[model samples]
Target: MIYVTGERVQAYQVRSAFFDTRWRGLDPAQVHDYLCRVADEMDRLHRELTTARTESERVRQALRQWQSRHNGCRRRGHDD
Candidate 1:
């Protein structure tokens, strides 16, 4: 239910979004179907986010190792 400008939107929020019940309101079945689709998309986004985070961490670790190994390459006139 967090609807701030830049806040993260989770699947539950998408699935449980409140419908405007002041008048006839939305069709329940159609709303459920659409929410399910949107929730599925949110799940996919979360999976992609996890994958990106893992890959970013792996690349950062590799870069740290490379930097440690090549801390003084130019100063020693050695190119590898």
Candidate 2:
């Protein structure tokens, strides 16, 4: 059983309207172009979020590794 978060649901609702012909009205071509732009922006945001998450994970891993190494050295009485 999967649960959809409120933010995810809202985002889907916003994107769904872009595809609804009734809401899009007579200017189909214009609507298509506008939606394409929105899609591009969304893609850009996703890439940025991916990069940020990867960087954060790397920093967390590095901090853990450093702490473990420091602890090991301290245990061995290597006080400097």
Error of 2 at 66 (Å): 0.9
Write out the backbone clash pairs for model 2: none
Clash list (residue pairs), candidate 1: none
Q: Model 1, residue 77: what's the lDDT?
A: 93
For residues 11-31, could you state the per-residue lDDT of candidate 1 as single tens digits? 988888867655677787898
* TM accuracy, model 2: 0.59
Cα TM-score per model: 0.80, 0.59
Q: Which parts of model 1 have CA positions greater than 4 angstroms off?
A: 22-25
- RMSD in order of candidates: 2.1, 5.5
Q: How well is each residue in 1-80 modelled by candidate 2, as lDDT tens digits? A: 13467554233343455444676377877766676677667777878988999999999999998888788778788863
Off by over 4 Å in 2: 1-26, 72-80
Give me the displacement of residue 26 in model 2, in angstroms.
4.7
